[model samples]
Target: MSGHLLMGALLTGILAGYGIAIPVGAVGAYLVGLAARERFAVAASAAFGVAVVDGAYALLAVLGGAGLAEPLRPIAVPLGYLSAGALVLLAGLTLLRAVRRYRGPLTVSASSPVRAFLGLLALTAINPATLVYFLALILGRGAEGGGALFVLGALLASASWQLLLVCGGGLLGRALTGARGRLVIAIVSAVLMLVLAVAALTGGSPVG
Candidate 1:
């Protein structure tokens, strides 16, 4: 396969990347919330961090995920459960922190951009279901000579979508500037995360 055939791999990668990310599950919601509450730079870094993880998984899928696919199946669901629990835990913590801040003098509590990036990266990394997803896609398409193209396509695709999310969050942050309003946003964000976690466990999309 060469020429246009290689471009097909890129197209496939783009479609697959969007397919995995478009559902905008727990971690995606968290990213949006983080953006709304914090600086856009921090949120953008976090978005890039998530995209990096997605690209890494895509790379792994194209490289040698086929061998691991069989072994990964048994644990994917269990890890997805753990991922759901993690989302719920994050929701609880988010609501608690928001309440604490709302009661006291308002504080920014802004996370550094680096910390935000690493935080999102680690959170996304724990999602073995994501790995399983890429592996399945690779197995279906049979990534061969176009492995690098696939990775590049996946990386760009996921990054673009995540950045779009950050943009929405940024707009939200601009609109709601009051402490009470921010607190409400946090509560709502927490609720959304909890809801998404339930959906993930109950045969819906996987979440981080």
Candidate 2:
């Protein structure tokens, strides 16, 4: 039973992590575009930042379960809306920056990898809905005895998927060498972010 429980928890965590990461939203889009524009190392750092937030949330879910979620439930909706507004602002800025880059020669000051890491981390961590999502998954899974392993599994799964995204972004960057291609990518990503933001404001789950 112990072995079975461990395996069960691990599988569940993997599913949960993948479920959360698979959706390409504002953050994911920005990540790809940023990777396309920046170095592989920077993109990788940002990818890990995204993964770290997922891992932290997974651990929190395992530890807190419904006990913690109860208090957060009341404010989740408002927080979601607020987060949506923030996303819109972020998207607009990203688009504007992209336009500037397109019009001018793409010149970027060398930035610390830590900036990417921390920026993505803060963006991902602010969503209250993510916590609720993880809470629901953890409660449903009932991995009481294997919480640590469950968290570990979720972290690994999230990390793997996020890294895959970084790789894809790098490849896309390489393929889209022209300024026009980069501009198109920027516009698409910004539009996606705007749509997701609107969805969040209307009580939609903003996971994607």
Q: Which candidate tops lDDT?
A: 1
lDDT of 1: 0.82
Off by over 4 Å in 1: 206-208
Q: Once all C-alphas are superposed, what RMSD does model 2 give against the true structure?
A: 1.9
lDDT of 2 at 174: 90
Tens-place lDDT digits, model 1, residues 12-81: 8898888777787877788888877877888899999989998999998887867878877687777778
Model 2 residue 50 CA deviation in Å: 1.5
lDDT of each: 0.82, 0.81
Per-residue CA lDDT of model 2 for 1-208, tens digit only, reads 5899889888888888888888878778878887777788888888888889998998898888889888897888777877787788878877887888889987863546898899788778878767778899988866457887778788888888888888888899899988888888878878888888888888776543
**Every model's TM-score:** 0.89, 0.90
TM-score of 2: 0.90
| List of clashing residue pairs for candidate 2 | none
Tell me the deviation in Å of residue 56 in model 1: 1.0
Error of 1 at 57 (Å): 1.0
Lowest summed lDDT across 10 adjacent residues in model 1 is found at: 199-208
TM-score winner: 2
